[model samples]
Target: MKKDIFIPKVENVYIAVVNEYNEIYNSQDWNAYIINNKDVDLEMVLIVTSGYNEGKITSTFRKKLERLPAKNYAKIELMQEELFALNNTFKVSFFEGNTMYDKTFLFRKNTINLKALQPIPLMDVKGVLVK
Candidate 1:
């Protein structure tokens, strides 16, 4: 038998993939969003790790986000270029009332729709594996 690891519910803020309008959506290009659902403002740092297939390369995208008002969200980066985008890991760190919060969101290749809009696109990186 395998035991399951429990992840406590993290309130106040979270990171997710959204559209240009900052809503949960799927599009030709998706953006990472830091959603502040609390009553107070939030300061955070979002680090996005993108892995490429060609040349077995991995790159990091960093954004220092600050003063995100309540009920608002900040768009971080435009990703998954409707082509050979492999996977992404979003690492978010923030503080609320002296309590620090950190979480990671993993978006695997299976979550992506390869045929987003029109004809096929090209992958900048070539031989990277999804796993």
Candidate 2:
């Protein structure tokens, strides 16, 4: 029989993806801040923390560092109304030209700008696989 890993789940957690220089690239639904480009092309660290107690929970993404040494990551910033976007789902595609990304890039929300936006940029994509 396999033993289960006793990982505790917490609410209101904060996640930030930083480079080796500690520049904030990506973050969770909240707390997204602008990052300096000088911190790019360094090791990427994904930090997951507990919200209620304010403690670190898990760290992942070292594998990505070994693969793409000079790659940059960006965190999505959520505005006051943009907080709703965290719960939404969207699709991605590789279509190009005037008909660029027609079918598979539909966003879930019905807001004006949100309705016609693609979450992830498709151009110059190296890898699209989720860990």
Candidate 3:
């Protein structure tokens, strides 16, 4: 039965953290984004995000989108600088056609930093991308 079960592999979807300038605050802010690079649209998209470390744990956040168009992106949330010291995890689940796909993207503790910034797919800014 296990051999007969089929689970599709998730591709072209990613979670990225970007450091963007906040004109109102006059400071750089860390933000999370969901990028959908697939050619097909995703339906009932859900994302659960949280951060944790040795003795510290941040609150879990749940976000839902009715649909995410192909080759597009959306902002997930604003991350505080303090969360950088903890392991940030983003659990994403969505349906493509009649198939459901799930994936978890993690940014290990202290891994989200300026030095790690790189060009992100489907976005104009550079940031840390976890595939």
TM-score ranking from best to worst?
Answer: 3, 1, 2
**Who is ahead in TM-score, 2 or 3?**
3
lDDT of 2: 0.25
lDDT of 1 by residue, 4-62 (tens): 74434557565555333334554345555666767877765445556555455567777
lDDT of each: 0.55, 0.25, 0.95
Could you tell me which 10 consecutive residues in candidate 3 have the lowest summed lDDT?
Answer: 122-131
Tell me the alpha-carbon RMSD of every candidate. 10.1, 18.1, 1.1
Write the residue-wise lDDT of candidate 3 on 3-114 in tens digits. 9999889999999999999999999999999999999999999999999988998999999999999999999999998999999999999999999999999999999999
Stretches > 4 Å off in candidate 3 = 1-3
lDDT of 2 at 82: 40
Residue 112 error for model 2, in Å?
Answer: 25
lDDT for model 1 comes to 0.55
TM-scores of the models, in the order given: 0.60, 0.19, 0.95
| Candidate 1: residue pairs that collide | 53-126, 53-127, 53-128, 54-125, 54-126, 54-127
Q: Which run of 10 residues does model 1 get worst, by summed lDDT?
A: 120-129
Could you tally the backbone clashes for each prediction?
Answer: 6, 2, 0
> Which run of 10 residues does model 2 get worst, by summed lDDT?
59-68
**Model 2 agreement with the true structure over 1-131: per-residue lDDT tens digits:** 24674423221111221112224754322222112122223233232211111232222111111211222344433323342332222222211222222111112232323233323222222211111
Please give the ranking of all candidate structures by lDDT, highest first, separated by commas.
3, 1, 2
